[model samples]
Target: MTRIFNFSPGPAALPEPVLKQAQQELLNFRGLGVSVMEISHRGKEFMDVAEQAEADFRDLLQLPDNYHVFFMQGGASLQFSMVPLNLLGEKSTADYLNTGNWSTAAIKEARRLCDVNVVASSEDTNFDRIPALDTWKLSKDAAYLHITGNETIGGVEFHEYPDLGTTPLVSDMSSTLLSRPLDVEKFGVIYAGAQKNLGPAGMTIVVVRDDLVGLARANTPRLLDYQVYADSGSMANTPPTFAWYLCGLVFKWIKSLGGLTAMAEINSRKAKKLYAAIDESNYFTCPVAEADRSWMNIPFTLADAGRDGEFLELAKARGLLNLKGHRSVGGMRASIYNAVPEAAVDALIEFLREFEKREA
Candidate 1:
């Protein structure tokens, strides 16, 4: 069997040990004699799983007592609407940072519910760089400032947190969550879809400050209301049991490997190696600014655009799967998430060298 290193952006690679553990318990989870997928989410066993998962995540993030972690069903996309629906209240305006496609989508959703002020934007620069924080035009009466911590499609990231003074800060951290350490106290809410560095596609993890829980609009649906989920422990409805279980394994795996600090060191080393390759080669170039480059997703282009398909084909033959970029971008993206081993990055570098030599 060919050993393939998957680099897909989401629904991406997961730790091998976690996968093996799931395989071992797939049909008979913890002597229950049924797949976790077949079990009731409200069952005591499942509740324990959910509780421990949340506890581990809180511990991993060093979450303060004021923060509440909720594992919900909707992807982070749903949070775009939920954020405004819950936090906007009587305020007619909110601030947004337009970093890339995801942030743009978030802004569009917020516009439907409130007067959105695009405080900072990189669209004029083709999403190649993060807008400088000093240039943002935050409104004095804005309800909250929303920013996408990492843009998956553009391969751009705000490595540092945005400052919005008294206005609450909300971030869509779908691609960057769990990839590194974060100061949980810096933001009012941080939400992530669970396919990148977490677990599967069905779960979204939200960490919201306790004080912000009861701010939902009067007509907000119970499911979309943060306060309801916070009050009920994210069990107001049936949750994605299997996905939650998988996330627990992932969190445990992260802990075994020394938590986010160690993970950040490894992720940084991986991105640096791949970016160094791209920057050094005349045949390849990365468009993002060095300061704003995403450690999880690195988008680069070939010097000769005509050879893009050829490069992808050769990369696939060598077991470097999913090296293609997002459809909107039309280039290559190597998403070196936590599960991607350093050896895989080294292998990719070797392939890049061989391919370039052949082209020359």
Candidate 2:
């Protein structure tokens, strides 16, 4: 079998060792004689798995005692509505930073439930750079200030967290979570879809400062309330048992690899290699500003836009797959998530060189 490297954005690559471990335990998990999927979520064994997963995650992030971590369903997109439903209260005004497609989608959702204040935006600059926080005009009485830490479509990122003055800060970190170390105390809530750096698509990890819970709107559904999930330990329903188990495996895998600090170092090296290749090549160009470029997702375009199809075809033929960029941004993207080995980036660089030579 050919060794293929997957560069998909989400439902992306996972560590081979984790896959192997799951395969080994598929029939019988830890002598339970049943797959983890078949086990009861409330059973002692699964409960232990859930607890340990949260503990490892907290340890990895150094989460404070005041913070509550909930592994819930509904991707980050769900949080767009839930954020306002749970945090907006009678306060109908919230602040949002519009960076790209995802951030815009978040803003649109918030508008349905509240009066959204677009604090700052890169739309004027074609979403090529994150607007400096110093230039933002935040509302004095806003309920919460929201930002998407990494804009997957634009390949733009906020390398440093923003300060929202006195307002509570919230972030959609779907692409950047677990890619590096973060100060959990800086924000009121941080949520990420599991498909990127976490595990699979069915789970979403939400970390909320304990004090922010219980602020849900009067009509908010029980399942959409942060405090409800917090109070119930994120098992309000059956939950995605298999995805939760896989996330546990991923968290363990990350710990065995020396935690987030070491992972950050590896991530930096991988991104540098790919970005350096783009920067040095006249045939290729990455439009995002250096300070705002995403380490996990890099979007670039060829000198000859007409040859986009040719580039993808050749790349796919060479075992490098899913290099296509999002439809909103018609270019090529290389998502070097945690599971994507550095060797894969090297292989991609080699292929880029070959493609450039042939095209030139």
Clashing pairs for predicted structure model 2, backbone only: none
lDDT agreement with native, every candidate: 0.91, 0.92
Each candidate's clash count: 0, 0
User: Residue 285 in candidate 1 has what lDDT?
Assistant: 90
TM-score of predicted structure 1: 0.98
Error of 2 at 89 (Å): 1.8
Q: Which ten residues in a row have the lowest lDDT in candidate 2?
A: 157-166
- How well is each residue in 1-360 modelled by candidate 1, as lDDT tens digits? 655999999989998899999999998989999988898888889989999998899889999999989898879989999898888777899999899999999998888899999998899899999898789888989989999999999999878885556789999999999999998888999999999999988999998888888888777788999999987889898888899999999999999999999999999999999999989897889999999999999999998889999999999889999999899998899999999899999999999999889989
